[model samples]
Target: MAERQGIGEPRFERERQDDAQASISWLPRRLDADAAEPKLRRFGAERFEPARLSLWAMAIGRDPERPLAWLLAADHLPRALLIAGALDPRPRQDEEALVLDGGRQPTQAQFERWWLWERLARPKRWSLRVQPATLRAVALPLWLGYSRGRSGAGQERKTRLIVLSGLSGEALGALKPAVLAGLRERTKAQTDAFRSGVPEGTPEPG
Candidate 1:
């Protein structure tokens, strides 16, 4: 069983440099969702603005729960315009001097081939990004066994793009707020850690 860790503020530390700065000790809990238990897996994703957020369908960064949340809210976007974040592990350096490296893929084909396919098949040490919005956009309704009714947000669309089961509108409201908050916290933590050039304090795996 995964060790039961209490819910609390993520670990934080301050470096004694030219000035004092605080950073959260953060690392993704589960990287591969397909290999791990459902509850423990995390999706590596950030930037949750409307239709602009795209996550690795399987990348679990500091937070394991963001991917599914993103997938659920993804249909709100235009197309494959989701901002996919790459999760290349930074090299170890003196905690005070370590900087978060820029994770950018040069081309979309490269990102699609290397990050999505090869990584999925081989399970090697690599990172990029993924998205389930389109897949989920269709899959979720079918799985739930409910077609989108013509009344609320999903009205008039061919995909019947609305919830039909869980929430009041058959939607997922609760999950979004919590997941969005988690993403925000993760972003802040990463930025602070990088700015301080401190190796991350501790892994906050869920």
Candidate 2:
């Protein structure tokens, strides 16, 4: 009789596509679908007409159950596009920052947001030369799941993008504003950190 493989056994060979999507698990929190549609539509129309207006989102607190909304720029733009997902240990490195193996082949939407966010993050090095309105043309959605601090049961930690079994829009709406605000602040801080070339007052990247 043949011996059966254990649960931990490698079942299928890891395909590139499979690995690409796997990185999305880093931010597995369900995006605000209801808000996403309207925000994308409204912003799509007002991306330009002005400059300096940008998008922001951030996470906060120890073991945060959800993201906090810190800032929403008054600037508007085209609809934000949803991409497959963002890869881990960002800044893909190849001959010179090439996409990594098993990395998600970003759609057109992903390309836009990726370019914009990266520019925003390193404004000193990168340029915000594009018109504000055109910024909307490239915003992409990233669904992610990640864990901070300790793991295992009874762990003092936070898990993002968990599947809510039966939460209604109304229930989620109650917390939307705060969450969005927190996310905005977090986003801004991230960009600023990159600009400062010292995230959280840490050493500059070499």
Candidate 3:
């Protein structure tokens, strides 16, 4: 049986994507006892819970030592707004150019559907920052304080995931560093993979 202590960060090294995936045939492995586990001192809302943490633990727990290859076919999308350097650079309407040319993207709604997509993005688009070492995820926006960690002008963004695991203050303090380190390493590898497409089966970290 796994130890009852907090989780620990698994050993990890970088490897090619295909080789990594080849090692993991089915699901991501559960974490080993060596992995650091943070204590949960408090609760924010009802959504973040041990179940969520367990899910996260299960997802990357596989081969904690191998480098992480984040599959981002749908992640880190640019905002629909035409902000200068925001998510997407396209104009508010996806068809400004097309309309100018008297045409549009092949759609049945005459571009209304595309417009609707852009409309809905604003409310749901909560920018999130990936926590390192601990393998925990955090939202970056202050408005999202309720769901993610609370952050404002002066506050450093900490994780709001402690409640999920029901850890105490001491456990939270102890687990902070481990979680940050793991998350940072994971995020770094993921960012690298996002920049360059990895092979199908990259090895996962322990």
Candidate 4:
């Protein structure tokens, strides 16, 4: 188990400022921005921001028996399962953070397909009769570091986005594309909704 930071800490003040615009239900995060700052600095980011990514938790195994749990990213496209170990999720509100709800919730059928593919790679697990035992929404904490291009000082400094897992404090280079795609889609949906005078959180038109 990882150590969790209490909400009363002074470091939360900076996180609150960084994520003032977004909020959502989140799983209790073990790592805080302050604790992840030193690693984030290595990216040479001009500034670091805190954010959250929506994920779906599903238990897949024989019904009536305890099943293995998995976390799937809520991105528009299907992605490999995230490497999250045992989680003790609890509701903790009043924590301000930028929650990215840009991805679609993966359907049960999608999970089945992914499971089959995964099993094919592991022949020994083929006999395991698995199914989605339960499904629910959850959020993973993330840190976004914004760094400028290393071009000449006279040249414009284009900002680059670097993502890291707030849980293990590891850089998520492979998931960067998916994260960027989700952000773009979310921004587009919000813009479209605003233009049509629709309230925020309204489902985008099909």
Candidate 5:
């Protein structure tokens, strides 16, 4: 008998930094650091961290040439958010500094099953096909705010995270689960590598 493979296996590239940065599209950030700081302050966050999430875009329905596109979070836990129309991502400009990219790349099969079909319930009205060549990966900007607060007097203060959209500076409560899952996975990987001894060329965790 053959062994069974998990559907969520990390078969795709682990982290495509240089290649993705060069080729992949990026959603423009309308809120700069100066403008975002005040927004974070309102949430009582002492400091903020900038990050990026990799999203998968594909045209679904009967026509592969449809103008509208679907955007999938494509992280550890996939979430689907439908864009109104076609994807028109802007290139990262020179002034934009690099940020940590969270989320794993999903295989075409996994993307279709987990992110698309599962959510849409395999609508019979539309003819959906996964065209590997048509799949495009884009980066979405995010802001993570760190705030310290105490449950009650005499209790130790604990830090909390607030996620916001770097594009519109709006709170991203729905994406909290995906963000937390990605952070936990990254932490576990670093911890395991540390226990096994860090490699010479391996970069230190920031």
Candidate 6:
């Protein structure tokens, strides 16, 4: 397992398209055992957990030894939104931007579909800071929290996700074409295997 933690600053920018302001940011991978393990457990659970994939990515980014790849399945998005609302990060309907933090625990699924297209961005968009030593698959749930600015000026929504494993910068770059291609290839393979192993069109008795 990878250990050691560091705090890296994320750069965020606003991208307004079709009258919606979308925000994107990047965080480095520098995480300690205490921080990394708990995160992993929450996100790795088999329950109907709430969480933001972005928040999970941010937590991983805070540590340098974690894998660089994250899989955002469709079933777990509601959990992320509930956490976001509880933290009261305050979604901007005007700008269509909501920055969630990994601090609070959400009860309901909110903002689940706001990021449908965001899932397609799993492999290509994010830039990795550090390479992972090993890749382990685990299911962790989301932990949500909110940090309010003094005098009600602002509030920040926080979320954290612990995953099975990620790709290291070096390991990823060693693949083919480019690092992202490598990550995508690996993720795709894993997903394909998972799908293939599932019983297709099986009916469950009610």
**Clashes in each model (backbone N, CA, C under 3 Å)?**
9, 32, 45, 0, 0, 49
For model 3, the stretches where C-alpha displacement exceeds 4 angstroms are: 1-42, 49-171, 198-206
Report the lDDT tens digits of candidate 5 across residue range 1-206. 01123556455432332344346787777778898899989999999877776665555544566634564555554455555455667776554443444455555666566445544664652455544445666777888889997678888888888888877788877677767776776688778879679767878779
Let me know the TM-score candidate 4 reaches against the reference structure. 0.65
Q: Candidate 1, overall lDDT?
A: 0.27
Candidate 2 global CA lDDT score: 0.28
Report the backbone clash tally of model 6: 49
Best by TM-score: 4
Reference-based lDDT, each prediction: 0.27, 0.28, 0.25, 0.63, 0.64, 0.27
Better of 2 and 6 by lDDT: 2
For candidate 4, give the lDDT of residue 104.
55
C-alpha TM-score for every candidate:
0.18, 0.18, 0.24, 0.65, 0.61, 0.19
* lDDT (Cα, 0-100) at 98 in candidate 3: 7
RMSD of each: 20.3, 21.8, 23.3, 13.0, 7.1, 21.2
Tens digits of per-residue lDDT for model 2 on 1-206? 01123356455422322433333222222335454334333323211110011122221112223222111111121222122212112321122111111111323333345445644665652532222211111111221122243477877664332111011112222222333343565577677878877546676657
Order candidates by lDDT, high to low. 5, 4, 2, 6, 1, 3
lDDT of 6 by residue, 81-189 (tens): 1111011123322321112222222111222232333444545423432112211112222222222223534655333222222211111111112222323445776
Q: In candidate 3, what are the lDDT values of residues 69-142, reduced to their tens digit?
A: 21111011121111111111111222111000101111122123333454366444222221123221111100
Ordered by TM-score, highest first, the candidates read: 4, 5, 3, 6, 1, 2
**On residues 1-206, what C-alpha lDDT tens digit does candidate 4 reach at each position?**
01123456568543542232133336666678787788888888778878777666555555525555454545444554644345555564566776665355555566677777777887875665434444555576788888887778689868888888877788977557666876786798788777689765778656
Question: How does candidate 3 fare on TM-score?
Answer: 0.24
| Full-model lDDT, candidate 3 | 0.25
Worst 10 residues of 4 by lDDT: 16-25
> Model 1 Cα displacement at 155 (Å)?
31
